[model samples]
Target: MSNYTVKIKNSAKSDLRKIKHSYLKKSFLEIVETLKNDPYKITQSFEKLEPKYLERYSRRINHQHRVVYTVDDRNKEVLILSAWSHYD
Candidate 1:
């Protein structure tokens, strides 16, 4: 059972649609599933993004791209704010 419900914003949905690499898209989906279970669980690239990103957290999809999201513990939700190349 998932402890957190993952919600992707329309902008993030647009970002996913722009991904040309099939494998990278697959990796993004897998990471979303992981977030549903434990949004705070640290992976190789998972890290909190404060000061700059407020309460958001980021997880790398690759050297170029990442998923940026914020977790709402009170409602058990994870809102995906962005899913695209970080340097863009």
Candidate 2:
């Protein structure tokens, strides 16, 4: 069983379906699985957004894509807010 739970917002779900590349989609899914274990632990390209997005965080899916989320420490849940190509 996973230590933390991951929940995707409706907007993020829509964004996920818009990914056109299968390989990219697969990679994003893999990262999300890891997020279920610990959203704050994936430091490769993860960043806590600045003042404008306080309490929210982002992890790179690739050079162009990103997964934005927020962590609820009290409940041990990771709420996925968005998944989209940064340049889009």
Candidate 2 per-residue lDDT, tens place, 6-85, comes to: 89898777787876555687878777887888888857888888875479888888898888889888999999898887
lDDT of 2 at 54: 78
List the global CA lDDT of all models.
0.87, 0.82
Model 2 pairs in collision: none
Model 2 spans with C-alpha error above 4 angstroms: none
- Tens digits of lDDT, candidate 1, 1-88: 8999999888777887876455787888889899999998878999888776488899998888899999899999999999898677
The true-structure Cα RMSD of candidate 1 reads 1.9
CA RMSD of all predictions: 1.9, 1.9
lDDT, residue 8, model 2: 85
* TM-score top scorer: 1
Top candidate (lDDT): 1
Candidate 2 has an lDDT of 0.82
Quick one: how many clashes does candidate 1 have?
0
The superposed Cα distance between candidate 2 and the true structure at residue 19, in angstroms, equals 3.1
